[model samples]
Target: MPVSKPLRKALQHTADECIDCGKCMTYCRFLAESGSPLSIALTALSADENVDALSHRTYDCSACGLCSAVCPVNAEPDNIFTELRYHAQANGIFKLDQYAPLLNYERLGQRFPFKGESLPEGCTTVFFPGCTLPAMFPDATRIAFKILKRNNPKTGLVLNCCSKPSKMLGLKSKYEESLSALVHTLERKGIKKILTACPNCHVTFKQFNTRLEIVSIYEELKKSSFLPVTPSVKEVTVHDPCVTRSEDSIHKAVRELLKAMGVRVLEMKHNKSNTLCCGEGGGTNMHNNAYARNWSRKRINEAQRTGVPMATYCAGCVNFLGSDYPTAHILDLLLVKRKSIPKPVAFPFNYLNRLIFRFTAL
Candidate 1:
């Protein structure tokens, strides 16, 4: 692929900034002897040098930002990958398949139940349930909605995709178009505050310059006292998504939420600020499934070491570990024994309305 002058300059800039301090190796499992040279070469190469090879390694990146954190010089390997993904897609070095689940965002505006329906006039906060939350894990989705309705019935929700997957997949044009639609939808509905459940979506939409206040649904639960205590004893390990824990407070919030639910929170040694990538975030799941599965398996094994089920805030993390661990969303844990267990979809276990009372009341 022929790289333009501007792209070449950017790649050179990335290579020049890297200090080769080996800090990135700690976060990458694939940074062994043979791959070391490839990493170095990719770092050193101009944007035009071996576009396929660059894009191949780029797709391998989960874009977790761990490398940036560990770097003594503060060099950002993930941002370099992001820049490359943009340049590569624009220059024809990358292409995403049509049916890839990430592309579902483009179809969301038309399919959402709230499309033509009007939200209540007086509602100030609207829950924007991202697509994966509802489709992949229906039971958890119901619990999230149930929690909001039980405490704050006035809260309306705009159900649809956030188009982050599309952006990660290098479909920049499509991502922007979908985002514009979503923005208009919120504007038309008079939604001023958005409560997002999906970590990826929450972070993605937060990047846009908009007036609507975006807050995590978990944050709202923490403040509104909307979450109910359930009697359930389960040792749970949480897999923090790279996108969600940028500031590390989300990790603490998740732990607090779990502890409040009577679930013993077990830490993965590499958790909190140092959590491993979920392998789905930065286009890896779409471009390379086997790699994503391998990473997910590694995480599942770590969770299994604790001898308990796992919980995560991100739907992608749960979907990534489907059927591998006795995993459920944090909302699912909260819903246990309160409402009837929602029918198990092809996703995480609901386990709601089945709370083990022995574990209740702190």
Candidate 2:
């Protein structure tokens, strides 16, 4: 199959630019194994690379945007890798049976299997609790939503997936279809803005659904008064989700909320736009569990240095990082006052929790 325009452009750009400085590989194992984007692009364009191997390497990328983050020439190798994954999938060159579980989970999200919405009259904005949060911690989701509604009566609830799984899996058609439905639903409901509880959803809406304004729920929380809590914890390290790497304002909101609770914030070595992945990025774990945990362990190693609990804004991040250390979501911290992380919810329970929230919260 002929290379798609986007993929070809990304390839040509990297080939023309990247000077093999190796800066992007400093923190990425995938880049270390696969070589610089310039090398990959040159070999690929010359037909000197094996297609399957290259495709596998591309899919192994965390899609964490770290490569482009450090690139002095800004070649955006992740973009090239992303487009190549799409091309491979579209052309039937990509297939991994291990992805069956992930595909099914994404299908459930796209199907509105357990969706709920509360769009009352005069409600122009929605509080999207997102998939993982509501699934794993329905109570926390309820608390977060109640806070949202309390802070702004005009606020509403939207329990829908952002179809990010499809997008990350390189299912271009499915991603567009599911995302279009979300866009249409927001437009039909007259939702002018979204307050996302999950950073991934925030990124999704901001990237794909420009028709509606996107705001972080943390930002919203920062704007309101919270139930006053005597501080049992004095310090924490904030794990800024890699998905929200560019959203410095959201990061500030999280820290401000922590400060309000009288907790001192510890900065990680890699933070803000340069924050490390929680290892769940790019659906790479579906391909290589060890590789995914490698990223997670790196973050754990960083958090361990501070000798403090790690607080993150995303429930998904908490779930991924909790096993190695004491990690809790910002909402879990503010609403529930949790000191220890809960066990990661399994499949049926996670789905059941979402279903229960459908009846109870929405």
Candidate 3:
């Protein structure tokens, strides 16, 4: 498929502005193999080279924005690669089988059988426990909503997918359609705010919606009531999710909550805005397993730096990081307070748990 005007403009900006400082390549492997943003842009936009040849290179990016974060000249190469991905998805170049999981997840967005929304009397706000969390930690999902409901009588529960998988997969037109439908749905439900646990959901909704206020559950939980946690691991490393990289408030809120619980936060080298991806960014794990594994390994190694268990906010991180290292979602610490890290649920059980949680919560 030919490069669209927007894609071309982004590429041209990188090609013209990138000075090849290689700061972006300091941590990311994708940039290492693909060369500087300028070189990639020149190769991609060159009249002689077929854009089709770079399909693999484009999909390999985790789209974690580390490149843009480190670039001295602010030539966001990640944004350029994102545009390239939309081009690949548009031109029918991506392998359908490779993206089956993301495609299936997107298909269930609003129509999800377990999306049982419960709005309180005169409610204008909701606790949106997004897809991954509900699947992997249904009890924590319910406990999160219960805390919000107790704090704000107007706050209610809504089990929904933010369709971030669609956005990451570069389903441009379809992604817009999904976002519009979600906005309209919230409007119909009189929802004015979303208190979300999923970092990707917070990022995705904030990107497209203006009327509805998007907030992190971590921030909300700061004020909301939850059981006092006697933390299983007192001193722990924190892995901030990529979507909340720049949301200083969210990062602080997480730390404040831990501090209130008397849990010591041993900082990782990559924390806060500089946090690495948990291997699940941009649907990269679906299309490029090796790249995804590399990212997960990086995060795991960072946790070992402090030589303590890891606590993160994103449930996807808990799931992907698996048992390779001791990692638990913050909600698990606050709500469940297990003696050890919880293992990720298998595929069919994950769905079953969601369904059960939805039915039982209703």
lDDT of each: 0.64, 0.83, 0.82
What are the models' TM-scores?
Answer: 0.82, 0.95, 0.95
lDDT of 3: 0.82
Residue-wise C-alpha lDDT for candidate 1, range 1-362, written one tens digit per residue: 66545545555655667667676775575443224322544544734566555754676667777766666664555665666676667777666664365564446433633232325668777777666665555555566766776676777756556777667766667778878877877877777888888887788888876688888878777765655556354677787887865746567777887777777888886677677776666767666677667677777778778887677777667666655666667766665553332333452222221111101200
Q: What is the Cα-based TM-score of model 3?
A: 0.95
lDDT of 3 by residue, 195-250 (tens): 88998888888988558999998998888666656878888888998878888999
Clashes of each: 4, 0, 0
Question: What are the RMSD figures for all models against the true structure?
Answer: 6.1, 1.8, 1.6
lDDT, candidate 2, 1-362, per-residue tens? 66777777888899998999999888999888889888898877776234445765677888899888788988888888888788778777778577887777666765565776888898999988788898878887888888888878888888878888888878888888888888887888788998898898999889884779888888888888777455446899999989888898998989999999888999999988899999999888888778799999999999999999888988788878887788877787777755465667877898898888888876
What does candidate 2 score in Cα RMSD to the true structure? 1.8
Model 3 lowest lDDT segment of ten:
47-56
Show where candidate 2 strays beyond 4 Å.
48-53
Model 2 residue 229 CA deviation (Å) reads: 3.3
Whole-model lDDT for model 2 versus the true structure? 0.83
Report lDDT (Cα) of residue 136, candidate 1.
53
Give per-residue lDDT, candidate 2, residue 246: 86
